[model samples]
Target: MAKRIIKAETVQITYREAIRKAICEAMHQDERVFLMGEDVGRYGGCYAVTKGLLKEFGPERIRDTPLSESGFTGAGIGAAIGGMRPIVELMTVNFSLLAMDQILNNAATIRHMSGNQFGVPLVIRMATGAGRQLAAQHSHSLEGWYAHIPGIKVLAPATLEDARGMLWTALDDPDPVLIFENVMLYNMEGELPANAGPVNIEKAAIRREGRDISLITYGGSLWKTLEAAEALAREGIKAEVIDLRTLRPLDDTTIIASVAKTRRAVIVDEGWRSGSLASEIVTRIVEQAFWRLDGPIARVCSEEVPIPYPQHLEQAAIPQAEKVVAAAKNLLSK
Candidate 1:
């Protein structure tokens, strides 16, 4: 029922506002769409993404649930099965672990368990990653762990267009979808396309193309990778940057194609180094494009230690531009 946006006009927006606009657009288009989460109505969201939504949409649609993640998550799943499109927002990825039973056992399984008689068209949005010095309580990035499951789609939107578009597309999905917005990206400012609309959720996007090596990454790490690419360019070492917008399905074709051409890869992820999404991408490259590799695949990931509260320690624990540049250089030298 929504009309395509006209591309003649342009606007600058923050990542938080883009997501809020997408939610507003979806609710306006579909009567069944609603948003609910802790402090989502009155408190304006943990990151202020829903600042005015409660007043605009009213109490019924912009519900403010109690502090129980498991309780509201299960409720959202039930509501989705009851012929309503519900976007449930958890404050952080660490909080989502409390609702793993509902997300993994219920929302992701209803379609197959019921012989295709029922589907859970739920959209769960949460802030993920570290850089805020919020310690382990709120700064962990576990979206990769969620990617290990069979059902549900995992999306990480690193740009303004994606922040605006992925939400509506996720709402339209028949199965459950999880959108992970990096906590640090909420305040990031950028120019969005005048008529930015739904983007393809099935493929990886190449931000910068080069032949030397592929800088494979997603989420907040994309910008750092891009920065590293520019720095490498100065030294005459071209690096291709691949943004993996979707994590669960892992765009194997695009990834393999990029690796096959570059013949080398360095994955940057905010998740832990061991058994992370970076590891998964590296494994895929080894399986499909092993012979294409001119050197061992390099990975820049967060250290295995807990995210510290101090600024310096937290920065050290997370992947940075310098580390990515070093990783790229090491791969080329090999």
Candidate 2:
């Protein structure tokens, strides 16, 4: 069969509105799909992404679970196994830790553990990254931790198109998928194709094409990297920005090709530096394109500290545009 088309004429909308549209479309297309999470029903989503979905889908489909992450998450897993496609929402990445048993132990291992007889066609959506001054407890970027797992698919939708399209694809996958939406991107407004639909979740997309250096990132860090690229352009340095939309699969092909062309790289990640997704990407670049490199790979990551509540400290704690520019410049100068 020919591949499905998900794009059409273009229109402008906010990032959160795109997400809400995606969920609404998915539910309308398939009755098997339903949404469950804290404040998802009458209260709307914690970030207000689901503000009007409750009335549209009703209490049955738009479930409002108690504040028990583990319990509701596990219930979602069970419901998935019973032939229902459930979208379970965790308020934040930090709060997702409470559901680790159900996610890591069960959702990520069920297919292999059950000899491929059982599949978890579930989607777990949660907010990630820092910028809201929610403190350490509420603002953690643990998408990297989920990416470390083997079976479950990890996705970070950084752009309006991905926000509008990824959910339907995730719902179609046989295995479990975790979508990490950067809380800061919710209000971001942009124009998207009116016919936008499910996009391929297996590859990275180069937001900007350049030859001097490759700035690789995903989710919240994407826009920052793009800004840094613009700054580098002003200084006569062209930088390529790659958005690794799928974290677990790590789209090594796109990453390697970019590094092979640019010959230098700077990874920007919102997670802490040590043993983070940025570290993993750097290692991959070294292993796959070491001979093509003109300089040592560098990374711009969050400082090794709990995200502080104070605005200045929190800004310091995470990767930003200036830091990415500096890292790229350093790589090019080397």
Candidate 3:
């Protein structure tokens, strides 16, 4: 058989071009790979990430599923079991709950339950976090909930590179992987490497460095925390920002090192304060670096309420740059 090649000229060439590249590259590299989800074909995905893909790969490879979350989700799991690589896109994580059994119980457990005999090589992409005022039904950061489960990988791609690189990595793994793209980051522009380089699913990336404090976060909160750090600089406070790229592996090493140096930490998460990954991160610092603490741990999290329809209220419900700044200052004061 002749080897396959994707012409560099074929790239989409835009801010979200990398996402399309990731999908295209995977589909081109492996004949087993295909995409299935609501509006993934003719509609080009909810955010158009899969735009033009159906045309290029054709409908068989780029399948547009029905509104039935559980049904199509279950179908994806079955296809993966039958030796096909399926990238199943849930319009949003909120809708994925209806298919929870297929994901949490089926896709996540098949490998372990079979004593590693049968595995699910499935990649599920979903929009996560609050922004654009989609309200409670459409917006929810449920990656944390999924992270709590075993036998699956949870990824939060905060940068353009990860947004492009993660899909290939996820598809290669023998187990299921969930890629959560923050709605707020889809259009954000950044220079992606000519070649997305090797990415690890077990490590965290430190987005910024400083000594006064550590702003630990991931996904949508990363931008806000970095902005807050910039604002704190004028006051002589240097804040280090860490992005927890893989929520499941929970890179405590990187987080502990930063907190150990700064002696103070503030976790900014879009999820509510209680029982959140933010709380888990703070607890880790307290457990590993409590003696080095210069102040009580602080957190800036979304308010405990269902997302609202009004734009301003939705803004108020989630963590913002100003709130991050205030939280950083409060930690500095103690």
Candidate 4:
């Protein structure tokens, strides 16, 4: 079967702008939708993604909460149960650790616990990953941890289209959804159609196609994998790049098929080596596509450590284009 393509008339915009527009559009279209978080109103969001939205939507829709992640996140879950669609921003993934009780216990389990009568139609947005020298606490990628939960949907919007489109679809879902926005990608610019809207949150996307090897990744790592793909091309090695948009579902069909076609695989993730999402992807490929493999699967992941404060150490800790290229090259050699 031929690969699918998405065509749109797009204009250049930064990743931050695309996200801001998506929120603005969602609020304008649905009166039930409201945003609440630290610095969301008067302070214009921690990353300023909600800048100017307070004036347009007013204090009612754009609320600023205290530094209580557990409190506000729980409130958002309660509000969602009460039939209101709330977009709760937790500032950063590290801070979200405070709200894990509400997220993992309440938001994720309410529907099943209530026998399907209750659905937490909540959207939790948080900044994830490292690159800004924010040290171990402020910078970490925990989307993999969230993806471990069976009930909630985990999303990492790596591209402009995804940044602009995924939130609305997530809000419309009956269960809870967590959107992990890589802090490094806020300034990344790309062309997005003026009319771009909600996109399907079900399947993975093939960002770049090849037959020699498959480099699978998502979020901030997507760009690094793509860069590695390009570098590999120069050496006459063609690499297929698969972006796992919705991490929870895993999209085994797309991943298995790609590995089956290429006959080799390399999983890239920003999380640590042990119990990481990359480990899960590798396990899935081995389980489903074992017969198709021409060599052992490889992985490029962050070094097992609390991401360091120093620039050089931090760079070495996370997966990079060079690391991905080396992993893919090793796979092809065998």
Candidate 5:
């Protein structure tokens, strides 16, 4: 009898670097994986995540698409249907609306409409949330919009581990996955677990445990929620922070369990109050844990207005640390 040895491998890197690593590794693993978007090739991406990728992968796989969002978006869908794994970067989710037909109509509905004969193996990455003064047009949280679609998997990678690992999982999935990377979280540094490989796109992860309140949030708002939780700790308030990595297939079990213990929840979302992800989450709580509640559910969401350009006003427009704390306190009082 002969014995065979099996070995595991992994790497550690920053959030931005992790994204590049996953893309490069996935491309190396499969020839079908290709990237297309404005400035993704020659300019090295707007946020520099795909920097130097074009030089290594060449222009064919590392395509520099034109500014026509709708046209190139449709092209990406067509390429995906033609047996290619196309990663389309929309620059920002706000601009993705221009290509809604290509995404929602084609990429998201193809497999179901075809009677499960075909799967749209497409990955769409975009910078989302309100910050950096990009204002109303460039900065908007559209994850809810993508999550609303049936065939798409919407992911919000709030940590470096998920940032590196989710891409692989999303690419491997047999349907379209939208990866939203908050602009403020790109530079955040954290240790990547040695065994961190592919993360599930359908489950939520509890980042911190507490029994007083559940600070639920995802993407850019995660940091702010954590900050608010830290402050609450000083005043002897316990907060269980939940990082909702995926919005579409939301982990209701984790959320419901936390809310059941705390009997209170404050959802922090960087989107407008009305018709936002926060609203949907609150609704879920009402449906699942209405009897378990100790007080009325509360939400700390962005003001219902265009994101202001001024730094101070911009801070006021979105959910900040203080805002989250206040919301949590208000809920606790009720």
Candidate 6:
């Protein structure tokens, strides 16, 4: 019997499935690449994004580590420094905190500390964002926090193409790379071209073009921002939607260009508003493109509170299209 394989030839697929296919393709292409994490093997991963990979690749490569994020993540870093490509999966963004020292102190500083004598070609994937009523400890969008650091790249794949394409490109990078998959986007249905493969991890993509204002966002908040753009369009306001695909090395050119053109910007981020990626972008706009602005910049971010477990509270705490729309309108009025 001919072996059946995953394929996405202009067919509808979920964000989760696209990621699994990317892992499969990468493993097939590079013998040095391997996946390691809690429940990543027999348990098919915490979110099942690595399902069937264990059977296809075997235990040697599909390692299921104990509940020690720091231990496994450190091991993955060592493997990378030893010339092997390792994909370390931290079950949730919250859990990554356990490995902070390993990630920030070692993986992020190895090359610099060693004076370019070493490189950590490692990729760390984790589920992020507040949704599904996971409560404070289990949920939060901290990708923006990691973007604060230097020597590492941060990527947020908001669409099917990115879910399928960004992994390999990140793996190809010489330093550590972190990929944050919004938990809410796993079930999202989308299409990817059959030939879709590695995508650029260096710049932002303008999802929609407009002249009224720029709706800047990334990850789970991107969809809400896009919906707000559509709503604004119907109300005679053309809002450009910019998806900051790669959070770190933040594609400042794309953001400054969009804000300079629209003359207004509303940053919609699932992370907290205080000192967030949104704030960084806004500060950059003010510093670099202040003259192009026609109105004050606004931000629609998660309310300043630990994400609530109740569905209503959770939804209200995070950025929504309605909030984005209101912010845009208020900016336009100002």
Error of 2 at 141 (Å): 0.4
Clashes by residue pair, model 6: none
Please write out the lDDT profile of model 2 over residues 63-104, one tens digit for every residue: 999999999999999999999999999999999999999999
Q: Tens-digit lDDT track for model 5 on 1-334? A: 7796764554556789888888998899999999999999999999999999988999999999889888988888888888999999989998899989989999889899999988888899999987799888988887887888899889999998899899999989888889999988878776676567787787888888899999999998888889999999998899999999999888999999999999999999887889988899999999999999999888898888898899899989989999889988887772
Model-by-model lDDT, in order?
A: 0.94, 0.95, 0.89, 0.95, 0.89, 0.94
Question: Would you list the clashing residue pairs of candidate 3?
Answer: none
Off by over 4 Å in 5: 1-12
- For all predicted structures, in order, the TM-scores are 0.97, 0.97, 0.94, 0.97, 0.94, 0.97
lDDT of 2 at 79: 97
| Alpha-carbon lDDT of model 6 | 0.94
Off by over 4 Å in 1: 1-7
Model 3 clash number: 0
Candidates 1 and 3 compared by lDDT, better number: 1
Candidate 1 accuracy as lDDT: 0.94
Output the better candidate (3/5) by lDDT.
Answer: 5
lDDT of 4 by residue, 211-318 (tens): 999999999999999999999999999999999999997899999999999999999999998999999999999889899999999989999999999999999999
* Shift of residue 286 alpha carbon in model 3, Å: 1.9
Clashing pairs for model 2 are 9-194
lDDT of 1 by residue, 1-334 (tens): 9999866677899999999989999989999999999999899999999999988999999999998899999999999999999999999999999999999999999899999999999999999999888997989999999999888999999999899999999999999999999988999998887678888799899999999999999999999999999999999999999999999889999999999999999999999999999999999999999998898999999999989999999999999999999999988883
> What does the lDDT read for residue 264 in candidate 3?
88
- The stretch of ten residues in a row with the least summed lDDT in candidate 5 is 4-13
Model 4 CA deviation exceeding 4 Å by range: 1-9
Instruction: Evaluate model 2: give its lDDT.
Output: 0.95
